[model samples]
Target: MSAGASGVGGAISAHGLGGAKDLPIPSELAIAGAVAALVVSFTVLAVAWREPRYDAATSGRPAPAWLDRLVSSRALAVTARVLGMAFFLYVAAAAVFGQDSLINPFLGTFYVLLWVGIVPASLLLGPVFKAVSPARTISMAFAKVSGVPEGQGLYAYPARLGYWPAAAGLFAFVWLELVYPYSTDVGPVRLWCAAYLGIMFIGSALWGTTFLERADPFEVYSSLVAKLSIWGRRDGVLVLRSPLANLDTVVPRPGLVAVVGVLFGSTAFDSFRESTPWLQLVQSLSGSRVWPDTLALIAFSAGVALVLTIATMATGVTSDTPRRALPDLFAHSVVPIIVGYIVAHYLTYFVEYGQQTLIQLSDPFSRGDNYLGTADLQVDYWLSSHPTFLAVTKVLAVALGHVVGVVAAHDRAIKLLPPRHQLTGQLPLLAAMVCFTVGGLYLLFAA
Candidate 1:
């Protein structure tokens, strides 16, 4: 978590949000982790499963009929939508009416739960946000009332647009959280959400739920991570597969590389901007930190995308596949790596601040009320207290994500590249993956 203004009716501080800073990960551990990532990456390239193993159309055995029926039931779908809408409205009321204070639940819901929590929730429950997305629910309701079929819109969604809208949405979010000075402020953040909801509603009206699938940042992100969960579907039947195999099922789409760039780069920028050197420089600029931070954010995001584009395209390609399409084809492999790094970056923050948020949620109005009986609960800071254990966990998570990513990319390479160039074509992507891991470790150490 990052620092901010301490109390109600005050603007956010530029330092960072949340409370209690993490001790910098030890230099030795950072090096060891980076070395391990490099070693495991090459090892996977050399000896891992070489044949193309995961196919969406044929992989994964059908799950139990009863379980599938329960999961796909109309009653269950309605229940999920109702619960999602109810929760959205509950926190939305807080955003609209509650005190502009750190104690407000709206801030927590937007920043921590919705933004950070979506990863783990989707990993565990498979596209959990999509199930409970209020945007989708409201759009469906409007369609029904207007006598239009649900998910049927005014026009066919443009395939070429792909995930670009989602990429933009993601950049907007990271900008708000990392670069925008008043991110913790109630009014600005609320306005952002209002605009998000408005755009989602209008887009869904124009392009149907396909717009949400392609444009909703949280949905796109959650769905990507869901590919790593054991849960899956084969011909609309619930099935289970190895997470790696499940991950291989992701279909390449335009702007996927951009999504990868923004997620990873913004996170790196988050750490970089908070480093002592950066803080001192920005503070001495004799101007607002907003411009510097915004520029840095753009640089980081663009840097990642550029590296990815060059790395992916700097390879042999068959005549059947355009060189330009290679980046999106390989973009799915970056999902696990991103998830792994995010866990390392935000683990303690989410666990600790998430608890704080829950306790605060019990008293959304800040009126000395404990409606949820959780107001008195205390956050356990054991993770923050044990710096070594936390550091090791972060390193392990990064390494594990790297290994999975390498294997995913390797499989895709075998499937997509010419037989003669399969091994050679993968070299650049593998190197890029190593740079991402090592650079992430360096940030964990230096920043």
Candidate 2:
């Protein structure tokens, strides 16, 4: 949604990723994709497995012995921690010493590398942030020095607060990204990083590392997406769960719906805010665009949560599972959709700016130092140049996500709803999912 070099800002501008974009898909193709999603929804309902298929304890097959051993080894763990700390320190140095210009690698690293890159990294590596998180490393050091048990704090983490903190943290991040006008400034972004580390450290110390799992925005987001990866565990043995099964294993926790809502909604809002109408409206206004944009962001997020809640609860539920609990319980179904949109929204930005970040990292102070041996590398714009392929890929990604979401919601419905109500109970949620998928396609087409 964001694009172009502007008068006031440089680098990845506040509104643009700065490159040629895929032409909008034809209206016919967009309609075809939406129809495909609906057709697949019913096809799954009519012929797919009726009994729930995933169980965290039994779903995946264990990996080979040697591979599992290497993966779970302490040596590998320590190496990952050291590498993580090294990367964090490298970026921290840039923030401390670099200029506030567009060339600063910190900007690309934050907005592109870390924020957008985490999705793919975690997908391949499984909870990658947890492996190398600086806050987590420091928290461990603190626990060891203070003689506290690992991952233990002053008290037990309350179960009632499940994921709420992470949801709030994620919102804060998207606000800073999408709403806060000074998002690209070095000082402001640096301060946000400092505050993030500070909060992560303090929270981990008080509540142990458990706090980070449910509160550190990056950790939570990465872990959520990791569920879609082929890597998983069965009874503490390394195993591979199919993405669908892995997705079904997600625990139904309080505030889970809000977390997914913020993720999907923020992305949709990014497209909306960049639309021509929004641009004209904001431009013609008399004041700062902050409040209008903030309200719009909030509305997008809350709107997703509202739709999910209402759709999931509209049908009759059993005595054991309240209608109110259905949203969070069914929330996992939306993860694939979120991941799909993430891929569509950030693919070009991540690949193009990612290369730029590598180039800039070699010259963190903007003084042309080739410290990382990557300063001489040039970015490949092949992906950006091939607009047709890129556009088609985006539509397919959205459609694939929609299909997975439909299957997930369907499985959960049949498993939870009474047999008589199973099919009927899924109709409302199916419609809601279709709307989301169509609207997302519309945004990409219109963007």
Candidate 3:
């Protein structure tokens, strides 16, 4: 089995089925596979650089008839839609009925399991999410409300509105979820869910049938990802697709595994960082040294960025591969990234303010205090006690992580895309990294 698969299997066996003490170190075989993936990624880049038109297979007419047929099948699309919607409904219900305690161990564990197991499995099986996405269902509902043909006219828009605005709106919603997780509470969650569905139905009616036909950002992103897979074909060959497609091709699966591992692991690490007084004592010994503080902060941020980037890239790449066709890559990436950030950012609170806040809110029957009553007050208290320098360091750390993640992503893109497109995709990412680095330094020193 692949290293990614093995790591997943091991994690499942250890965490899912076995006790924490029974957890095993990642197998050596898995590490080797990860290394091999990196090697293959570089190899593809080198070859693509030398021969732009190099063909690995003699049969050079677009991918085999079977591959095209499989992707285009309407039955496959319907199945994916059903599955995606089902999963969303299940999670939504769990979140609402089970309360805060349901967020972890139950909902959280299920989410992880689906990503590692179901998502990957769908690449070979079909577009799993497409079969059952809440978003799609909402859109269909909106179509009905707006008097548009059912599922036919939901995406119509003028060129002036552009895809970016829609993309930005989606991103904004995700950011809110990440930055303010309370938005997912039972009442708010249901309201937002209904609102989204209403919007889709209205949009479809106003825009005519063409609205529903409009290309979604998620679909576009997925196509780009699918183009980068080893199974991606411009011709009947196993060669890389667009030279610009390099970002998605390199040791795709292992890269994905690493991203997920780091995200979850870092959150755990942060929890330990906050909860472990011994570690705090060790940190205190550094006495606010710029180097150690900066390093710690940067590591934290980079961990998050890496996780988000990998998850986004993976969704983009694998959406149309032999494995699966995930149409809601945008939503999937947004939800997890935002949720993870909220959890990580609040780690300190969970530790320091536990007795006063989280512990109480987590209890379903608590009557003396509520989230807004005692919990918010405790957060204010903890905030007052935290050192200004610590906050500064944390911000710097986040900036550094973004820089590292952008660079890593750029490197992958440069190696995958054609030489011409290499600079196009990579330059922006590089510029962003530079800007983040400069901003971080300024924050570190100016504060």
Candidate 4:
């Protein structure tokens, strides 16, 4: 057997750790944390909306001094623009030079990472990409072209509808990723990418010049951070002027990192499991039974729910109601939806393919191959040569996985966060982060 095939095969056979019927306690615990986060976010929002004073701490604040420097730094702006241009260029090159066959794995993996990981994480992190966003970079380029002002006062908060819309949009994105596998040919992929880029460009055009002045979610979050960092000062202006900040002001909570880690880790785990033949083999052997599959499916659903709930709680806790606040909307509604998309998409892959498919794909290559570099080609040809029904089934399985991810993400976001938290908003995002991070690490390395 070729070294590559041999290694893959060895990984597959080592899957005998345990049966799939068992549910890890860590997974269950993580789910509990997710639930708590949701409840807390909702409670806080409800209280704040019902009473105006709840928002007093969060409201008020000129842009921070550092923010002024950050936005106006020519060095940072140039670097961002360069990277953004590079990303688009790479995509274009891949489309032009890469063969269709070569594109599948890359596309599949890329879709998984984008929807399931990056999108959701960004939402949770509060316009995280804005600081280093390619779109932001592109926007900056457009700003230069249009002669927009570049100063601290330029970036301000605009409106608040909670975070639901962002969440919904994220859910839609995940659905697209999951459905891509089953969708007809690669035509959809091209269309999707084009659409994404177009939307980004249009949004940039609309806000590039006035992004700072506009009441956006990011501005609110930044403002809130700046406010919390201020000590012994009621005046927002003075708070911004203080250059030396304490850890408590800057690091909202130690747990927030964990929450981000777990949310992000789920996607990472999905990718690792998908790529690592050994992990798949273990999962297959343990989860092959109907009961095991059912358990896994349930856990997957629970995880999605947890993400939405957490977002709702976080938003509600942070914002005051009847304010129609922009930051609260983005932080609570938008971020969670993104996270949902990521979790749902990856979960779909797990449910549809399970571990058996991976094991089977690794089988033929275990025995020595007569053909030299043609092993992958042989495998592909063999799969194509299979009975029509079998080939179709395999393709459908792959497609279905993506679909499940999208559905779960969207449904969870739409159904869960908004209503519950509006009445009593209080979410513990930082706490959730700590729990998720610890849980994820346990799953990845210790478990």
Q: Model-by-model lDDT, in order?
A: 0.83, 0.83, 0.37, 0.35
Report the C-alpha displacement of residue 328, candidate 1, in angstroms.
0.1
Q: In candidate 1, what residue range of length 10 has the lowest lDDT sum?
A: 11-20
Q: Lowest-lDDT window of 10 residues in candidate 3?
A: 1-10
Model 3: per-residue Cα lDDT over 171-197, one tens digit each: 323332322334324455445545555
For model 3, the local distance difference test gives: 0.37
Best by TM-score: 2
For model 2, the superposed segments whose C-alpha errors exceed 4 Å read 1-21
lDDT of 4: 0.35
Residue 143 Cα positional deviation in candidate 4, in Å, after optimal superposition: 3.8
Which residue pairs in candidate 1 have backbone atoms (N, alpha carbon, C) closer than 3 angstroms, thus clashing?
2-16, 2-17, 3-16, 3-17
lDDT of 1 by residue, 324-443 (tens): 999999888889889988888878767777777788888878888897899999878788678667777878888888878888888888898998888888889888887888788777
Angstrom error at residue 209, model 2: 0.9
Which of candidates 1 and 4 is the stronger one according to TM-score?
1
Candidate 1 stretches greater than 4 Å from native:
1-25
Clashing pairs in 2: 2-15, 2-16, 2-17, 3-15, 3-16, 3-17
In Å, residue 71's CA in model 2 sits off its true spot by 1.0
Instruction: Give the Cα error of residue 73 in candidate 1, in Å.
Output: 0.8
